[model samples]
Target: MSHAPTGARRREIWLLVATFLVAVAGLIYELIAATLSSYLLGDSVRQFSLVIGVFLSAMGVGAYLSRFVGEALRGFIWAQILLGILGGFLAPVVFYAYAWTGAVELPLFGLLIAVGILSGMEIPLIARVLKEIGAPEFRFENVLSVDYVGALAASVAFPLLIVPQLGLMSASLVFGALNLAVAGLSLWLFRSDATRSQWGVWALALLLTGAGLVQSERLVTVAEAALYEDDIILSETTPYQQITVTRFRDRVRLFLDHSIQFDSFDEYRYHEMLVHPAMSHASRRADVLILGGGDGMAAREVLRWADVAQVTLVDLDPRVTGLFQSHDDLAALNDNALRDPRVRVLNQDAWQFVEHANTQFDVVIVDLPDPKNLALSKLYSRAFYSLLMERLSPRGVMVTQAGSPFYARQAFWSVVQTVAAARNPVQVGAGPWTLPYHTYVPSFGDWGFVMAAPFAPKTGDLAVPPGLQYLTPAIWQQSHVFGADTGPIEADVNRLQSHALVGYYLDGWAKWFE
Candidate 1:
């Protein structure tokens, strides 16, 4: 039944190998574009959702254009070459474009469409080449299946191998060369095609460029120097998060997406705001729970109160706590906070930890991040508040960093409402001044807090820990009122999964680069 000969089988195997490379190129380009966007932008889920939407739409447009593809082999060769050039340079183009283009997005949508169309058209062209060379009709589905298998390989390899090993720039270039290799193979297989010589030049350029980048790893760091102002002291991409520690002498800073988690110089303001108020208001305080201060700033604050018999701090990232434990500069910031004798550090997601908390606290301080996406927003959800309520002793106080009451006003109140609805007496508070720290970061400004309880305080007249540089009675008093910086807006519709901060962050921050 099969018309194809053994010699043809050998030739077809080589062509399939070429198709495998093409598939790898397409997938890496798709994932790299999505990955870079997720890295630069704060929310991975939102960035990836938009990227997949745009890419799929563009791929549909591309597939429709395949009907007009007349010179099949020539067009396919040119496509591979172009993909090599464009995909290889995409990372740098975006990085530099962020600095150069004062406004208007890097036409990432347009690039997505261009690359997606080209990528979508790849399989059809491969099938056409195979059919022209006397391959049996039964082989069509098998060829397509092989193409998808290669794509799966690329997907598994990109995040796990390529990215961590090569980083953005080098990885792009290496994958670009892979595209060029596909072009060269296409030329060898289909030498009669008009695009052969052009493919040669593209292949040479891609190989040389990729090999050059392999040697210039240090230059890559130097190039990244422009994006960050301070010296790049520590940079790592952990499974949970990207952590960057930078320093300007005593002013070491930990940044999660351009948002300051802590600055060695002045984090006392943030920690004091997060911990002391709730602890001071606690009724006969003895036990304490801190939800998310992996850097151990709040733990240091909690340990100061002599009545606190045990302080349990739950944070998601071990690397964060590890740094506070091991990194010299980090330990100095919190004054060896996590190492303190009374503290028990549980490195786990507070969302999961609170579910299993058998022990209640006199004071529960929620030092969670602002709800940027669904995963984070749920921590601000009514369900999570119910858990918090379960973990608080009767007549105890819980406080949280409710974000900027001005910029994310409704987002801040959403936390309060979620808590209030959870059968807790949610007492709201406000204060605004992180100054130039949060000012440059999107539309973010004017930070605040929320205090909630099942009943009134038992230790309302408690003493302050001696080392506090901020969180005085006056600052605590000012932190309670909602004065203009943008009064509360649309609290009810601020769903956790839908994530209101997504809109606010994009709008407010998108202006700065422009």
Candidate 2:
């Protein structure tokens, strides 16, 4: 029943389409800024909150400034062009800023404000253009609805498709090109409204974005090399995190989201100290459970024991396990432990796996990262420890890698106290006796671990494992002694409700690093 659209009607439809495209582009830029800041800097909560706050406030500034524009069509086109250029190169710019200057706060926030202001001007100018074309009175409402829908589309696509498929740097460039394309389409639709100079500017911006897209990989490599001292032999942006491996001569290092996990030169000290203590303490070592050791280093130490029949390793990221399992150099580092017949690797969330687990282990080793954020904080909570205790055999022993005893004193003791506080309802009495210990590794100074069990773990006359790079009988006994400065302080029990551990960990590390 619908008739062919008139010239004015067609112009209004095109303006609405431009409105949708602009909305999508704007939201994508905001997400990219927030995500990139979080990756470069730790404490994701703080980075995301500040970036969103600054961007939104600047958007308000842009909306207020839009009232001064006399020519709606020209203003909208200019905003689109500027936003495309700024947002297109945002990731690389921020990355280089962090690499070269060793700080990113100034440039990151400056570009965020500029892009927000331009995005804020877009919808208002589009509405004005729709009115100028003699569209319906309800056209403003239609513009708002379309804008909202486009925003939803962007939010869903960002994590599911954009980040995983194209990555942050390439995604930004792609969305930027889409923004410029919208401007070009508007110019062609209303050819009389745009000048020859406007077309020329648009063409130049498009060319620049295309060139950046073609060289995105090289740009990432150069920026990453500047950040690290060693040569970056492997780098991949997985769905979960950025996994980078660097090598200097014979020494190799693994970094997850810019945080150094381990340095090959001194990694033996960390791994031997982590695995052997609990393995020797456990009454039975036949069935061992490791929560987070995807690199296979922990499994290598576990396999050192002759009595251990099966070692079950559960890690969240498949890319990490696959790398250790397949890569020649990485696999050799773990002695190909992950490919052994006795070891079973399951890629699943540690908390979820323990909650659903029905098997009881003779020894449980939790090798998770520090609880700097809410997601990681829960893994160290009293609730998680309680679930883990239920999975431990009566004579079983459990040990977790606490933070640095010297730098994060309270955080280290918090894990020790939290483990002592966990009460397994099925087990009798009020004790999950804890043993706190620390050893000095040159790569990471004064690292700590906490061992807990239904009964007191045997700390004396331990059977030390042979062929160990570190952790001798004398060093193992000495690790239990803490100096005055590194000794425990009063720390609140870490629970899910308050997440006290995250606050303690962040505040402790911030004092030293910031």
Candidate 3:
């Protein structure tokens, strides 16, 4: 039979628990900083790398500074309190900095480094305190093991529970509260070690973070409102992305991860141009597949053809498709296309869907976003297009929305080159003729598209249906013409192995935006 632990052993156990909690909180702050930066700044790879580098280096700095500490208990408690306040408020501060100033590098990285330093000092101070308290079996390895376990828990929970449930802003505050609670636990465990002033500071920090937690929704709204020009009517933090809808006067706009998807006023121009080109060129519009366009705008145009028998739209995000399908206002924008009897919506990744699809499509329309990251870059790759070629019928045609020809010249041409490079799996040595075109849309300037087929698509006799706001026969012919400056440049074919399109896209846009 085992007896209860002695008071001395109990104190050591509690201190080790405190070390574990500190590790959890510290890593939570690091992930929050990295995710928040990625959402605001774009280029997730660069943002995460930079944040991790700075945070780990700052941790080293904090460890080096721990050697000069006089009172281990007081120093540990102070670090917890300070870390709680800073890490808890990190998201809101960074959000506001980006929203108001149109810049975020300084405050985001500054807070990241500060939080890292405090987190770094935690384990060393805990070990020192255990030694001071005369822990019977105060092995440094035990404390380090607990700390590592805590870090693992935090890493797993952050993406699965914290981010999906609490979101970045609320997660920050919730973790901040947890840190203060840990500090309070330490004070209670050793009442004589902490002064009245330390307790007072901890109480104040708790109050601030608690209030922030309660009002985190309002805080997010206010911060997000400052980022856009119009009043936001709907906002949702989906597990996949931040979905926001804003309205000004009669114009409604959609934004995914702070990037404008479409402005209702001129969306017809984009949607019409995106959908009608391939639809008009295809010999049989009986079966169609749309890779993106979760808003159902592309489906709206496809339904214009009475010859279209079935339309299958595969999008990655259900929130986007569901909103466009159910929301009264958003549904009307798509003319209830997603709800039409002939349309089938499958919320699945386009790449995976194409690879496994057994049925062939008469017209394949790729209305996906630009190749901003590696995930998106694959959709524009030669391998992806090759897979798509297998899904295209013998006389079928496919069209993809390339990025802006004026701004991202190489990225635009890369799509064309990639599509042209795709070999038809069904017909060996068959020509996958490609046509590159561009048209002006007010919302997205100089937008481009590339259409490919096993045979040379007859553009001269396009059976363009009536009622199009843009893309008339004359306009369609004009879109094929590019100015000397906007003309295609030599570009590497985008492949899954290299993901060259993402680099070209990021580099091209950065020059204009930065």
Candidate 4:
């Protein structure tokens, strides 16, 4: 017959399990806090660095303070209960504070310190408990080894499974439950060792964690409500980015990963300039390709020409394309361009789409976001432009949204230089004529665009369509001129390996913050 394990063996098993559980739970909380901070504030590097620094310092403080506690087992149990309660509710509280008071740093850092201190004490107490119970193999080294393994698992699970499946708000509560589970199991196993106060704290922690689990979804909605200015119509977290649509009166806005993509009120100025400049100069507008214009605003501008036979739009996010396709207000804003018979939407990465494209386009509009990160920097690289050049018709035109020349002059010039470096197609030997232009949009001031064509383009050749709300022939030509402040500066070509453009973009925009 199988017999119950001896107390020593049981203690060894529970302590090891506790070490692993606490390690995973602790790192998950740290990641969630850092991610939320990055989303709310700009610059991922800065936010993550600060969160990790504060967490590790607090952990050191906790470890040092653990020497004062008399009972190791009691200390471990209380630490687990406190960690579970505070860490589980952290995300929701941070969000609520931001929404109600526009204060996030204090509450965020306060919770991180609390969770870190409690987590730091967990492994030390577990090691002490096992040694006291006469476990021969219970050493600090063994405890630390198991803790590191748990950390590796948590790092993998965070982005791949936790954030995508459970989201930041709910994931915290789930991990918090794991923390409480460790404490509850320890309480059951060591019932003879527990004091009255430890039992009461454990009960209260269970009640609080259970409530968080049940109300997780509602709590997430309430927290997210504060992040947007208008009423959120829909929000989805995809592997690539966070997609949010908000509506205020007749105006609608789309935000990708918490950065504003567009606001309906003044988007026409941006879209009109992006499209008409290239469309008007191109020899034929019949076949058009649009990369990264998921909202369909650019397509709407291209579709104005009755002669344009087909418009193929490639955007990375299906969530973005699907939202515009289904929403009545969003559809109407784009003149139902996504649903147009002549327009075909492909939900795929723009880089992959361009590299393998079998068809040639008379006009290609590159309306991608600014090169703020590595993934986006590749799109602005010379390699991407070279591949794009091969797909253009003999006399075709291409235009890219180069960002605010006034704010990011070096980045804007880098794009202009990259397009020119792509060189003119052999079929049309006259030039790889590059035209840099900027227009004032109230939402985004002094935005820039670079238009490149196989043959030299003339302002006189532009056949601008009638009824455009923003773009006039006079203003179209005038956009080529720039004020002294927004003028071009020399910049290195953005190669995939170097990724120098992201640095330039960051440096250029950093001044605004200062």
- Each model's total of backbone clashes: 4, 0, 0, 0
What residue pairs clash in candidate 3, if any at all? Answer: none
Clashing residue pairs in candidate 4, if any?
none
On the 0 to 100 scale, the lDDT of residue 155 in model 2 is: 91
Q: For candidate 2, give the lDDT of residue 360.
A: 95
Off by over 4 Å in 1: 1-7, 100-104, 189-196, 215-220, 284-287, 341-347, 425-445, 486-490, 493-514
TM-score of each: 0.85, 0.95, 0.95, 0.85
| CA RMSD of all predictions | 4.9, 1.9, 1.9, 3.5
211-319: candidate 1 lDDT, tens digit per residue = 6566546545564566667887887655456677887766787876445687666677777777777777776678888888888888888888888888888888887
Query: For residues 306-374, could you state the per-residue lDDT of candidate 2 as single tens digits?
Result: 999999999999999999999989999999999999999999999999999999999999998788777
Model 1 root-mean-square deviation: 4.9
lDDT of 2: 0.90
Steric clash pairs (candidate 2): none
lDDT of 3 by residue, 266-365 (tens): 9999888888889888889999999999999999999999999999999998989999999998999999999999999999999989999999999999
Please give, for residues 425-508, the per-residue lDDT of candidate 4 as tens digits. 654454477899999998788899998887776557457788888888788878989889888788998998888888889898
**Runs with alpha carbons beyond 4 Å of true place in candidate 2:** 1-5, 426-429
Q: How does model 4 fare in lDDT?
A: 0.86
The stretch of ten residues in a row with the least summed lDDT in candidate 4 is: 423-432
